[model samples]
Target: MTDQAHSLSLPRWKEPSILPGFGVGVGLTLTYLGLIVVLPLAALAIRPWELGLSGVWHELAAPRVTAALKLSFGLSALAALLNAPLGLLIAWTLVRYQFPGRRILDALVDLPFALPTAVAGIALSAIYAPNGPLGSIAAKVGIKTAYSPLGIFIALVFIGLPFVVRSLQPVMQDLDAEVEEAAQTLGATTLQRVIRVVLPALAPALISGVSLAFARAVGEYGSVVFIAGNLPMKTEIAPLLIVIKLEQYDYAGAAAVGLAMVAISFTALVAINAVQTWFAGRGRA
Candidate 1:
C-alpha cells in the first residue's frame, strides 16, 4: 500500500501532530506555577519550622490564637454556606431570565471585587451602627449587627457572595436544557429534574465557588477589622490576630497563627476539590 492511500484509510478523527507548541506551553506553565504558587507556599511551611515543636504548639494553642482560629474558620464556613444558595439563584436568574436593569444587576455582583475591603467595612459599619438608619430599625427589634460577631459574618458574606455567583454563572449558562426537557417528558417533577439532572451537572462549579468563598473569607482582614471591632478573644479573626502579633513584633506568633489558618484552608480546599472531581466523574459516567 502507498503512504497516501494508507493515510486516506485512517479515520478523520485521527490527526497527526504537525505543530511543536505543546512542549513550550507545558514548560512555561510549570515554571510559572512553581514560581508564583509552590515557592511561596513552601516558604510559609518552612518559616514555622524554625521554631521547635513545643514553641509551635504553644504559639498556635495560645488562647487568643485559638479564638482567632475558631472565629476565622467558623465564620468563613457560615458565610460560604449562606452565599451558596443565594449565589445559585443569582446565577440562575442572570442566565435564565431577562428583565430591566439586568446589566446593572450583573455588574453589581462584581462590586466587591472592585471595592476596597476597608471601604466596604466602613460602609457596612456606618449603615449598621446603632445611630445609622438600618441600625436604628434593627435596634428597635433588639438586634445589634455592627461591631459584633454578626458584623463579621456580614462582611465575610459581602466579599464571598461574588465568588460563588461568578463561578456558577458560566456553568449554568452552558448547562444543557434539553436534558431537563427529556427528564420532564419522562414525567420527572421539577424537583426530581433538578436533583437528578441539573444539580449533578452544576456540582463541580458549585463546589469550586464554595471553596473559593471559604478561602477568601478565611484570610480576609480589612473588611472584618472595622466591623468586628477587633475585640480580643471574642470577635477577632485569625488574620486580625496575625496583624496584632505583627504590630507587637511577635513574628513567630504571627507566623504560627498564619500557618495554622493556611493549613486548615488548604486541607478544606483539597477535600472540596476531591468531592468535585468525584461528582464530575460520576456525571461523565
Candidate 2:
C-alpha cells in the first residue's frame, strides 16, 4: 500500500497507455523540436550577442530601426484587434445561416492563405495606387492609400484575416443555439445574450486567433513591401530593415534587430495568453 501510494505520488514522465513505443515517441518528439525550433532560436539568441550589449542597444535605438519596429508592431496589433470582430461575424454567419453563394464566400476566406505573398503585395499596390479606382477616390479626399502607413495596415489585415476566421470557425460551429434561446427566454435582449452567453465561450478562440494574426503580421515581408513604399522612418518595417542589414553584410546588426523583435513579440504573446487564461478561468467560475 505504501509502495503504491509512493508510486502514485511520484511524477509520471509519461501517461500510462496501452499503445507501445511511448519512450520512442517521446525521444522522437524532443529530437524534432530541438532540431527544428530550439537550435535555431538558440543560434539567433547567441548571434546578436556578438554585438556587445551596448552595440545591440545602439542598433535597436537607431531612428530608422525604431520607426520600423513601431510601424510593424503597432499596425499588426491594430489589424488583429480589428480582425477579431469581423472574423467572428463572418464565422458566425457562415455557421448559423445559409445564403446564396455561401460556399463561394467561405472559399474566398482561404484565398490569402493560398496566394503567394508577392502576388498579393503587387495586387494590393496596384489597386491602391494613385491612379487606381480606390486610390483615385482616396486622393480626391486628400488621403494617400498606397505608399503610406494605411497601405501597410491594409496588407497586414489582408494576410491576417484568415487566421482569425479559421481559428474561430470550429469553435463557432460547436456553440449551441439552445443556450442563446434559453437566455432570450429568461429576458435577455439580443445584445445581452451575445455579451453574457456567447462571448465567454468564444473568448479563448478569439484571443488565439488574434495572437496568430498579430504574429503573422509582425513578421510579414512580401505582402507589405510593395504597398509600404519602404520609406525609412515612415512605412518601413522591422523585417524589411532586417533584410537591409543582411544585404549590407551586417550580420550582427541584423541579429540585433531580430533579437529585439523576438523579445517584443514574445512579451506581447505572453500578455495575450495571460488574458486568454483569465477569460477561461472567469468562464469556468
Candidate 3:
C-alpha cells in the first residue's frame, strides 16, 4: 500500500505511450542540441563582450554598420511581404489547377533551394547589369537594377520565394475545394470567399512561410554580396559587413555586429510568432 501510494503521488512526466525509450530519445535530443546549437550560440554571445559593452556599442554604432543593418533587415522584411501574396498565388495555382507544364513549374519553384548562392548571385548580376537585357531596359527608365538596394531586394526575393511556396503547398493541398464551392453556393463573391474563408484557413501557414523567408534573407551572404556591389552605407548588407570586419581582423567587431543581428532577428521573429499565435487563437474562437 505504501509503494502504491508513493507511485500514485509521483508526477507523470509524459503520457503513456506504446513506444518505449522516451528517456533515451530525449537524452539524445538534448545532447545533440547542446553540442550543435547551444555551443555555437554561446561562443557567439561571449566573443562580442570581450570588447566590453562600450566597445561593442561603438562597433555597432558605426555609420557603415548601421546602414548595412538597416538595409539588410529592411529589404528582407519587404521581400518577405512581397513573396507572401506572390507565393500564395503560385501555390494556389499549383494545387488548385491542372495545366500544361504545371509539374515543371512546380519543380522549378525549388530551384533556389538547390542552387548555390554564389551562382545565383552571379546569374542575377548578369541579368541585371547595366548593359544586360533587363538592366538596359531599367536603365533606359533611369533606374538601377544591379549593384544597388534594388538588386539586394531582388536577390532576397529570389531566395525567399521557394520558402513561401513550399510551406504553403502542403497546406494548400489539404484545403478542400468543396468549402469554396459551399461558400459560392451561399452567393458569396469570389473575392469574398477568398478573403473570408480561404485566408483564415491559410493565415498560419502563410505567416510561417513569411517568417522563414525573412530569416533566410536576413542571413543571406553569398547571393547578396555579388549584386550588392559591397558599397559602404548604400547597398551593403550586415552579413557582408561582418565579413569585411573579419577580413580586416576585427574579430570582436565582427562578433558585435553578428550579435546585434541575432538580437534583432530574434525580436522580429518573436513578434511574428506572437501574431501567428493570435491568429490561431482567433481561428479557434
Candidate 4:
C-alpha cells in the first residue's frame, strides 16, 4: 500500500494516456516549442547584451526608433480596442441568430489568418488608394486612409480582427441562452441582462481576445508597410524600423530595438493577463 501510494504521487515524465506514444508526444511538444519559440526569444535577449546599457539606450533613443515604437504600440492598442466590441457583436450574432449564409460568414472570420500578410497589404492598399471607391470618399472628407498612419491603423485592425473573433467563439458557443431567459423572467430589462449578466460572463474571453489581437498587431510588418509609406518619424512602424537597422548593418541597434519590442509586448501581455485574472475572479465571486 505504501509503495503504490508513493508511485501514484511521483511526478509524471509521461502522463498516463489513452493515446499511444505519450513520450514521443511530450518530446515533440517540447522540441517544437523550444526551437520555434523559446530559442528565438533567448537569442533576441542575449544578442543585445554586447551593447551595454548606454549602447542599447542610444539605439533605442534614436528619433526614428522612438517614433516607430510609439506608432507601433499605439496603433496596435487602438486597433485591438476597435476589434473587441466588433468581434463580440459578430460572435454574438453568429451564435445567437440564425441567418442566411451563416456558415460562410463564420468561415470568413478567419480570412485574415489564412491570407498572406503581403497580399493582404497590397489588396488593402488598392482598396484605399486615391482612385479606389472608398479612397475617393475619404479624400473628399480630407482623410487619407492609405499611405498614412490611418492606413497602418486600418491594416492592423484588419489583421487583428480574427484573433478577437476566434478567441470568443468557443466561449460564446458554450454560454447558456437559458440564463438570459432566467434574467428576463426575474424582471431584468434587455440592457440589464446584457450589462449585469452577459457582459460579466463574456468579460474574461473579451480580455483574452483583445490581448491576443494587441500582441499580434504590435508584431505586424508586411501588412503595414505598403499602406504606411514607410516614412521615418512620420508613418514608419517599429518592426519596419528594425528591418531598416538590419539593412543599414546596425545589428546592435536592430537587436536593441528588438529588445524594446519584446519588453513592450511582455509588459502589455502581463498587464492584460492581470486584468483577465481579476475579471475571472470577479466573475467567480
State the C-alpha lDDT per candidate. 0.90, 0.94, 0.94, 0.91
Pairs of colliding residues, candidate 4: none
lDDT of each residue in 97-179, candidate 3, tens digit only: 99999999999999999999999999999999999889999999999999999999999999999999998999989999999
Candidate 4's TM-score: 0.92
Q: Tens-digit lDDT track for model 1 on 1-285? A: 987887788886454447767667779999999999999877877777677899999888888888889988999999999999989999999999999999999999999999999999999999988998898899899998988899899999999999999999999989989999999999999999989999899989999999999999998988888889888899888888787789998777778787898789889999999999999999999
| Residue 284 in model 1: lDDT | 92
Model 2's alpha-carbon lDDT is 0.94
Q: In model 3, where do residues sit more than 4 Å from their true spots?
A: 1-12
Displacement of residue 262 (Cα, Å) in model 1 is 1.3
C-alpha TM-score for every candidate: 0.90, 0.96, 0.96, 0.92
lDDT of 4 by residue, 1-285 (tens): 686676687787533556788778879999999999999989989887788988888878889889999999999999999999999999988988998999999999999999999999999999998888888799999999899999999999999998888888899889999999999999999999999999899999999999999999999998999889999999999999889889999887898899899998999999999999999999999
- C-alpha RMSD between model 3 and the true structure: 1.9
